[model samples]
Target: MDFKDYYVGLGVSPDADEKTIKKAYQKLAKKYHPDVNPGDKVAEEKFKEATEAYQAISDPEKRRKYDELRQDYQHWQKRGGRGDYNWDRWQTNPGRGGSGSQGHTMSPEDFAEMFGGAGRTGGFGGFGGEGYSDFFSTLFGGGGGQGRGFSGGSTVGRGRAGQDTEVDVQVSLEETFNGTTRLIRTGEKQIEAKIPKGVRTGSKVRLTGQGGPGIAGGPGGNLYLNITVSPHVHFVREGDDLRAKQPLDFYQAIFGGEVSVRTFDGEVLLKIPPRSQSGKKFRLKGKGMPNIERPDQRGDLFIELSIILPDDLSEQELSTLQELANKRG
Candidate 1:
C-alpha cells in the first residue's frame, strides 16, 4: 500500500497542534458524515479516510511516532528504496505476533470476538466491503485487531462516544407556522421529533443519544434533524417575515373598498385607497411566521395587491372601461 500522509490528507502541518488537528477533522467530519450524506459512497469513503487520519494524528504519541516513520520513509525513498515497505514495525503491539500484510486466517467467531462483528469479513465495524486500509488497520488498532471497533468500522479504545449524525427534513410552510412533529428513523429505531414553531430552512433540531452506536459500552451520540421549509403556493418566507400576493377586484381598488386577505393568522381586512394600482404593497404587523427562538414574537407580513378585471363584462361596461382607459391615456 502507498504511504498515507495524514497531514496532507487533513490539510495540516506535520507540526500542527492537537487542537488544530481536531478542528480540521471536525470540519471534514461535519461535511462528509454518513448520516448527513446518506447513500453517497464517495462521501462515506472520504469520511472513513479522514477518520483514519485523525486517529493517527490526533494523539500526541501516535503523531510523534508517525512523524518519525514518515521521515524514515522519505529518506528511504531518497536512497532508491523500491515499493517494498516494512509495515510490521509500525504495527500496533508488534510483539503480539500480528502478521502485517502476510495474511492471517481469522474464523468468523474470532473476527467477531476481536471487532465485535461491526464490519463484514476482512473489514471493520459498521462499514462494509474492505473499510480501513490494511496499512491503517495494521499501524493503528483498526482491522484485524483484538480491539473494539466504532462506527465506520474503526477500532478504538473503550468509552468513546458514538458519532453524531444529521438527517435532512423538509416541512411544509404550514408546518413551519405551527409547531410540527415527525417520526424519524435512525437505523432500526423510530423516533418522533418535535420541530419547534417558526423553523425555516437550515433550522436544526437535536436529539441526544440518537446517533451512531457508542464504542465498547460507551454512550450513544446525538441525532440532528435539519429543517428545510417547503415551498407554498401563495406564501414566500423571508426570515420570519412572509410575502404574498392578495387578489382584489378592479372596482374595489379603483373605488376604495375593504378587502379580506388570507394570511397565516387567517383572514385580515385591508382597506384599499381610491385609484389603487396593481402591485400595491401593504404590511400587516404580527401576521407572519412565528419566531422559533422567541415564541412570543412574530414577523410582519407584506401583501402585494394583484388586481383582477371582470371577465364577464357587459357591452356598455366594456365601452365605459374603454372610455376610461382612453381618458387616462
Candidate 2:
C-alpha cells in the first residue's frame, strides 16, 4: 500500500490541538461517511483516509512518533536525498524502530511485538492473527483468541462512554436582563448553575464530570443545559434588543405626553414627542440582556407605540367632535 498523508487529508495542521482535530474529523466524517454515501467510491476512499488520519492524530504517542518521522523525512530531503528513503533498515534495528512504526503490513513476530504476547496463542483462536482479532474485537467484540470474551456469550465486556442528558430551564426576561443563578434537579442530583445574562434559546451550558458514571473507572462525560427564555407579558426580544408595545390614547399619539412604560427590570417614564404616530419606537440603550461573559455591557430595548381608541362615545362627545371639525374647516 502507498504511504498516505492522513493529516493533510483531514485538513489539520500537524500541531493542531485535539479539539481542532476532532472538529475537523467530525466534519469530514459526516461529509464522506460510507453509510451516508453508499456505492460512492470517492466517498469511501475519503472516509478511509479520514478515519486513518483521526486514528493517528487522536493517539498522543502515535502522533508524536509520526511528527518525528515527518521531521526526519524533511531533514533527509534537505540533504540532497530523495524524500522516499527506505525504512526497512530502521524497522529491523531495535531502539531505532521508532515505536515499531509499521507501514500497513506485519509479520508474525511483528504482530506479537505490536500487540501483547497473545497473538501467538494458536493463531488467536484459529482466527489467523492479532490484526484480525483487534479489528473484529473493535467491530463485533469477538475473536480475541478467548471465546469467553466474544460478544455472543463472551466474558470480556465492551467498554463505551455513557450517554449525555439534556435539560431546559426557563427564566424571566428580567432575570435574563441581568443574569441569574438557579438550582436544577437532574435525576437525584441537584446542581447549581449560573445562567448568563444574554442566554437565548438553544444556548448550551456544559458541566463537565457531572454526566453518567464512567465505566471501568474512566472519567464521566458531561451535562449540557439548554436555555429557554420565558416570555414577559409586556417585553419581547429581537436579536440583542428588547421590544414592547405600549398602549396610548389618541391624545398621546396626536400630542406628546409622558407615559409610564414597563421594562424588564422596572417601570420607566418615557417621554413621547408631539405628533407621535402608531408603531413609533423608542430605544433604551444598555437595557437588554446583559452580556454573559462581560456583565458590564448590555443590549438595547425598543418600545413600540400602540394607539387605543374609545369604543363608547356619547351624543355630546360626537357633537363636540363634529363642531371642532366644522370650526377647523
Give me the candidate number with maximum lDDT: 1
Clashes of 2: 1
Q: What is the C-alpha RMSD of each candidate to the true structure, in Å?
A: 18.4, 16.7
Distance from true position, residue 196, model 1, in Å? 1.3
* Regions more than 4 Å wrong, model 2: 1-163, 311-317
TM-score of 2: 0.51
Give lDDT: candidate 1, residue 197.
Answer: 94
lDDT of each: 0.73, 0.61
Please provide, for model 1 over 153-250, each residue's C-alpha lDDT reduced to its tens digit, 9 standing for 90 to 100.
Answer: 32334344577789999999999898989999999999999998988898777676788887656557778899888899999889889999988897
